[model samples]
Target: MAQSRKKAVKKSFDPQEVLDFLRQDELDYPAGAKKFGKDAIPFLSDLIEGTDENLSMKAAYLVGYIDDESVGDVLKKAAEKGSSTIRIAAAYGAQKRSPEVAEAILSRSLEDNNPSVVKFAMKSVSSMKLGKKLKSKIDHISKNFLDDDIKNSAKDLIKKIK
Candidate 1:
């Protein structure tokens, strides 16, 4: 029967639908785990616009966790355009999924005025741990970190980099 045949067909992929899901999930649980599949990744990618910082940050976080390299550019762009909170989340999230961007994030983290941003940057730098590469970078920017605790933390991190 035509009805039966139609029922057998799968639902069509809709970018808007996935975006709506992301928005709803983000609102419900910003820090909790979310599972947006491949079909939804593009929608999440487009949501990286800085217009809505919270939403953008959530999307970036989800995309980063998805661990898909395709979303790298959008995540990085969100990091650049988003508010400090959003930027920290975006940068931290993106870096976990892609170590290639770690160097750029370290530079931004060093210059960042926000303590939270610097902290996340430090965490990411520690995660990447690229032999001597991080040592020079951390040494050069150690003074920019305003908080002595953070400065000392960065120093401790540099020693562990090797």
Candidate 2:
């Protein structure tokens, strides 16, 4: 009986069930965020070009957590792709991963010509705790982007740069 029981033990997880679950939306973004981690670099690179701007942006945001250099490229592209929400999220994501990418985003955002994007970009940069390196970049943009409002906002970030 014990031998029969051992041989008859059923699998707890069915492969087909796993595939069906993976097809759900809730299982996609944040779940993808947790599972892919650094291994998502290649998948994100492709997702950036997807027709769904929201998905592209979501993928971009998650890609930043990958802690890989390629995430910078994807984030930069997302910021330039006209999905304001995605750009802001990617900017913040990049801020946590790469200072250079964050700086590039701030440069565009500081002088963005789009008030909303500039506002979001300023907010994102202000949240960065990147020390002197980010401070110097902020100073440069503050002086150069100098649109009064954007300059003042960047100054606020400079004060927080400690």
Candidate 3:
């Protein structure tokens, strides 16, 4: 008797399907849906570039969880133009996937109009190796940000960097 062999078929990329899969609350980093990083890149990229703010933010965060290095461009773009929530997520993702770009993105985020974005940017910056230029920029933010909370946070980061 001859056995029939089955060929595996690759599924087409579907943003909605990937979004649905990612929407589950139990997904954890280094396991779960994060293991599908390579498969989810295209869908997550579309969502990051989409106009829906909430979905875009969700997608940005998912990019961070995903292990693919190709996520750098999408994360940088989202960090530059996406809403504060998306910027925070993208900054984090970029920090992990593309440290060089993350420095610029996080530095630019320090000037974001939203204090929350600046706060998260400060958090990301703290994880990086602080050099003279970045330390100077952090000093400027600590002295100039309009929000006292952000200023204090920047000041605290400065102390940590020192």
**Number of the predicted model whose lDDT against the real structure is largest:** 3
| Clash count for each candidate, listed in order shown | 0, 0, 0
Better candidate by lDDT, 1 or 2: 1
- Model 1 per-residue lDDT tens digits across residues 1-162: 998755443244456654565667434433322444444567676676647766777776766666555656655665566678766876587466556665665556556677787778777777676426657656755666668888888778767764
| Superior candidate under lDDT, 2 versus 3 | 3
True lDDT of residue 80, candidate 3: 79
- Displacement of residue 121 (Cα, Å) in model 1 is 1.3
| Candidate 1 worst ten-residue window by lDDT | 25-34
Please give the lDDT score for candidate 2: 0.62
How many Å off is the CA of 8 in candidate 1?
A: 12
TM-score, candidate 1, is 0.70
Q: Model 1, stretches more than 4 Å misplaced?
A: 1-35
lDDT (0 to 1) per candidate: 0.63, 0.62, 0.70
Off by over 4 Å in 2: 1-31, 130-155, 158-162
Q: How far is candidate 2 from the true structure (C-alpha RMSD, Å)?
A: 7.9
Q: Per-residue lDDT for 41-144 in model 3, tens only?
A: 77777887788777777778877766666777677677778678888887666557556767767777766778888777777777765334478777988899
Top TM-score prediction, candidate number:
3
Quote the lDDT for 15 in model 1.
60
